[model samples]
Target: MKTQQRVGAGPGRGLAAALGATVCAAVFTAAALPGTAWAAGESPYGFDGGAQPIKGAATSLDARPLTAGQSYRDSIKKDGKLYYRVDLGTQENAYVSVVAVPKAGGAAEYGDGITVTLQDGSGAQCGYQDSSFASATFTRPITAYAHRTIEPDRSTCQQAGAYYVLVERTSKAASPPDDWQLEIRYVPEPGVTQNGPTELPENWPSSSPPPPVGGPQKRQGGTGFHDATSLRQGEWRADIEPGQTLFYRVPVDWGQQVFATAELGSSPTGATGYVPNALVLSLDNPARGHVDQNTVSYDGKPATLALDPHRPVAFENRYSSHSTTNALRFAGWYHLSATLSPEIVKEYGDRPVQLTLRVNVTGTPKAGPAYAGDAGPFQVTADDRDAAASGASGDEAGTNDGMVVVAAAGIGAGTVLLAGLGVWSFAGRRRAARDAARGGPGGPQDGPSPFGPPPPAW
Candidate 1:
């Protein structure tokens, strides 16, 4: 790839930016402007913002400084495309954050954006893989700045040098120069050796075998930000009425999941299904996030539940009256059984500081039905309720087979329509989440994703 391009370019300057990005930037010069940090109703939109509203196209370079509260903003409108740039520049591990604003809400719209491209000196494309940071995180804005790990990619721009950072917004036309604001910021990285200011490498060692994620992961410790998302069974509902008996049972020999948790709590508003016992779990506790004794709900009549990655998860929207909605963060423990090869078990089973979780609930307190596993697969078989009660119609082994496949295909087309392209990668994990992204878009058969091949035959 072409490595070197003319430097210091701007709108109509004929200067070329690395990575072929049209928009370019220079080191920011401090301004002695007054009240750049004002309060509410004093900002450009009279909304306590810091920077004034400057509008332009994503292709232009007249970008203005982001105001104070770059993370927050006034609801302004613009008729032209919003342009912006990200500069980590020599800052060893600087993090980036961006938020886009638009005018309409009816039909789904693309609000903010960033033109992302990684390359080495001379501008040759880098083949990247195993990207911990190369992800599209929903529930949050693009956060590549916070991630310190870069994947394995062959790039021509390897050495420490100028790298282009570009971002553009995609949304409906907005009311120009009015209550409009696009937020952006740069946060520093952690565990970094030196805080040396830096930019995207113009070049890196060609012989280097991509960077390793890190070494000796801690077991039974908090899940790092990299864990991405988790699917856990939250809690049981109901008031702590007298003599309330609640129960929960999970797999055993699957070896206990150290990083995960299983919790049961109740609310006072509505007296729903009642449980006899409950308590919070912490790293300070022995069972960790696992349950104790007598609390396990099983015997012949067991319970079966599913975590819909789509459908926004149960209790995600409305809170059960019997829940500690106002009391706690609504976080719950996970009833999980993992499948790991001997190698994986050997590698992580005994590691210190593993993924640890803290479990708790906020309402009235009671007790009973706590079961923790030491070793063995959980077998919650029900009798007259039909073998289907445990969710298996016939052979339990056959029932657990192809879990990923079943979860993906069974999702409605609406959910799949909502997910982004990069997320809809694996027919398994990606597809299920995609199904959840579906809103009022095309029908379930909106064809295949614009990013990948069509779905598999059922």
Candidate 2:
């Protein structure tokens, strides 16, 4: 019945087709909208050539405390850097990540690269990582994780006191950027108690990790946090810009396990120009804690991630018995964030990269244990799961029909676009094959015998 709501929330194909036709008719009857007028030879999306020097913008270092399962959203200017404070216990681990989104319209291109540094109160650098934008089009989130202390000794940053995180732009622009949205995610590792030899679970390395079981692939629709698309069981297809990031949420009841794989589609000519080691697929728990993460190069390979309750421990933190043993403590909405770096966009321009997503959400929702305390902010309702997946607003009941219609139209349009892309890709491959066979002056296969065996060294 619950899964039905996810699928039935949107209109059927027949209704969507009919509605699309009606919408197209309405569009034809209306006058065409005028195109945007801009100054000649100036970048339309860039600043209006009125960018000010970065030095002029004043910034104050304000360190805000970060907590587990919390994301702080703010903005930073081109010349400015944002700082946050984080405190760690000797027994706990800390993980931090920053995601930057360009502000709409009148934005100046602040080339790739944003630097994040972790330092102590005395200004000593601890651990830092710099994340470059995939392209001006999109940026993949950058992350860093560290424990309270290292055995032999690495950096002074691994201590029980206060640590600061600094985020700044690495590229300079003619005009100062208005601001870019930054989402900071912090995860506090669960503490572990040294219990005797650690009663190793049967799922531990005593047995090899199971290989991912191939399943149906599904399409993703939401390309950002605000519009993450809903997903159900089945094969789906979609296209993404080279540097685009997509968010999708799935409902996992108590005792459920989720497995997903993301694969890059071959280019039009069956060869992607350059692959960047920037495709990252991350899974977050209901509380927004970093449960697990994986990064893979888009070199025509699939990246797979599975949250099997049999082994909730992330490969990186498996040594920590406490965190891994209790990783799956919640049963609610799990968020999946998938991103491709801008290098693809830079090399391919507006050409879309097709992606096939395979998702397996198994298990039924079992009744949770009764709570003795008062109902806090989270009472856990049946609708909570679906609401998060749908990005539904407060007045969902009133706009159910409208939302269904809109979603139907969107899904229909997405399918048609994919079809067009497939045809274009096939045509490109055919043309390339024909050109190679011809081997004419302009063909890529021209003059292939130039350096064969150094002319037999005669």
Candidate 3:
């Protein structure tokens, strides 16, 4: 019996979902995973004990390509065809050992009973390779402490990606009573990650590619280099075929203090049809200069961006399978921006930043005519034409006169101080409730004026 599982592969749309197969050890999972990172310096385990034929039918460019270990002389009188490969025999960052099919031909003598199964090339089956049967098998095979965690199902296989084997025949019968051989053991990185860390830099390439500048033509002008290999390795994928429109020219700074931040990547085939991802920032550099743009649809692998806050300008495509490409087939790729907050050249002074990137292909913008610069010259005078047409003023007529009567006298003094604070707190709470309903000294209408001092003169 034999078994290995680490699941986690996805499927559903424009692509991106399939990564989870790095179990490395219940018996042998080949850990250090990154979508299936188990290259433990060459051998995660693909079997070499000797029976042969277990790696996904063969070398698997699509499957079927092995030759050194295959033998099946009519078992169930039918079953045959297997493949596996991985014998680095040497290390130093090198990898590819093999092992992921688990059982089909020998092992069973008391009565010829053996069952080893482990699948994920999309046949499903994953639970029954008994070390004891408490659940799935694995009391042996895949040495160096163990290994067997491959999850490749070909939608582009990448649940943990890294693959190289596919052994099959999970029923085992027709010739055998013992002596099972399939033990791939090659320890140099037993726990994995034996030498891959210093923070980052094994090949150090995710994309820092910055270099696409060629501005200044001025008269309906033109220059070059728009993603020039994204400077040779920073992410600039291409596979277009929509309307095809990709052009670049950035040196924007035309007049009008700016503050830029551009990021727009879209993909739409239908839904009223808009296809966003456009960035234009053109003024051809005259003062501020900003060109941040967007237009995503090589399925979302666009480029050109940097704002540096220490690294605060962005536009990523998340690409790296050891990338090395530039096959140009445009349909969409845009990212434009403008930022220059000193009031954008303080109103036109540094004249020297022109921009013109094109990409709206079938939707309209192939960009052609637009050239005319510097406009400044005026002379009206009639007291400057009554303060430019009548905000009328001899010396600024009464402080720009009646701004709606000063906002209605400041809303009538805040409505008379809130009606005198709501009538002095409601007349001081009704005069303390009429002095507590009069339970005090003077009663009988409260003395002092009864026919008055009549007997006082006697």
Candidate 4:
């Protein structure tokens, strides 16, 4: 049998093969590029890119199970209620936060928002929280969280069983009927092995300490909790657009008290109409549980929102009557979010406004609780404190699995591209030798080509 002679064995075929390899390499590299990072000043809320898509059930009977330390993305219709299940140990504290994003440019009344509740298997309520748009005239994302703590004094809802999370949309007739986007996160805290104080501190500082004294450092805020910029005790500045929310995380160690103030710079437009709740600054605990929030009206002038001073981070704070103090029970990265109402765009001409965060973390870092099990991300580590002090963003400060995968894929693509070029060069040399043996460019070619059939004409 005669060996099938190579077809189109020449410079053209070699060049074609190289081009194909190059294209494939380029495609692979493009696919591996980071696509989840959101721009700093975007309007709409950016959900956690790594969150799992979950379908919430209408009732507890058919509710889907949510695992601890996982984030889920779902949706809720107008006036709709949804249920999710979470199994907890007797000594573990479970926190579930739901962020509801209203339709952009849609109408929303002052009372429009959501309510989150944690209930036991018997339908006994463990915790409940309500978040509303309040005085803002435009739609934005509102976060509400409910938690079930293993307290000794708690009579009900403190068992090692399955619990249900109920999320309900609370809106008036004037609000838009569109389904709101939901970002749900479940964070579990392991019970401490060592016992700490059981009573609230009798005499703690109640007055807000002075804001951090330093020149403002430029830092772009992240769009979601997972990527919130890491902030330390200093003045940080970022530009925020109307209807945009920026997230930042501050590492608060045990015995440390965090005081934060958000200042919206004077509007360049010099517009006159006053917008209530024009700027909102919120502080959330490591579990994404609401600690405190402050809002201020804006009239083209600089507006400041400052969180009230609370008890320092302590395990006993959880026994306090106030929810704010209760949320300071752990030492971890406390998230701060600054949101600009969309109503400002109407009068301010949709320009980006300067946002300044004055953060002061007081008290020396002390030893934290010894957990029976792993505390996971609920506890701040030495690396976390170092990252904050170095002004590293969340992505740079912590190990992000998504980004690691992307980097690995990128390196692999580069290797493949380099190997393909080497093969292309070898093929070209062989083709040239074969032509020379046949006496010229117009010579006969024999033997099957090592490289498969030439790629189709480009």
The predictions' CA RMSDs to the true structure, in order, are 28.0, 18.3, 38.0, 19.0
Tens-place lDDT per residue, model 4, 94-179, is: 88888887665456877778888999899888887777766665676667788887776666877888899999997788777888
**Error of model 2, residue 146, in angstroms:** 11
TM-score of each: 0.25, 0.45, 0.18, 0.78
Local distance difference test scores for all models: 0.22, 0.44, 0.21, 0.71
> Among these predicted structures, which one has the highest lDDT?
4
Native-structure RMSD, model 4: 19.0
**Pairs in clash, predicted candidate 2:** 51-175, 134-342, 135-342, 217-235, 217-236, 218-236, 219-236
Put down candidate 2 lDDT per residue, 142-186, tens digits, no spaces.
322322322223446555788777777665555444566565666
Mark the regions of model 4 whose C-alpha exceeds 4 Å error after superposition. Answer: 1-43, 153-155, 403-458
Candidate 3 or 4, higher lDDT? 4
Candidate 3 off by > 4 Å: 1-84, 90-92, 95-163, 166-211, 215-239, 243-272, 275-458
Better of 2 and 3 by lDDT: 2
Between prediction 2 and prediction 3, which has the larger TM-score? 2
Measured with C-alpha atoms, the lDDT of residue 254 in candidate 4 is 75
lDDT of 3 by residue, 1-458 (tens): 11222221034421211111111111022111111112443212222112223224433345432332222111111123333332322111111122222232112222122222333344443221212111111111211011122122323222332233333333335533232333221111111222221121233223333332232111111111111110100112222212112222221111101122222233232122322222222211111111122122112223222321111111110011211110000111111222111111222223222222221111111211121211111111223222212211111211111122223234345433443343334434533442233221111221222111111100
Q: Report the Cα lDDT for residue 162, model 3.
A: 27
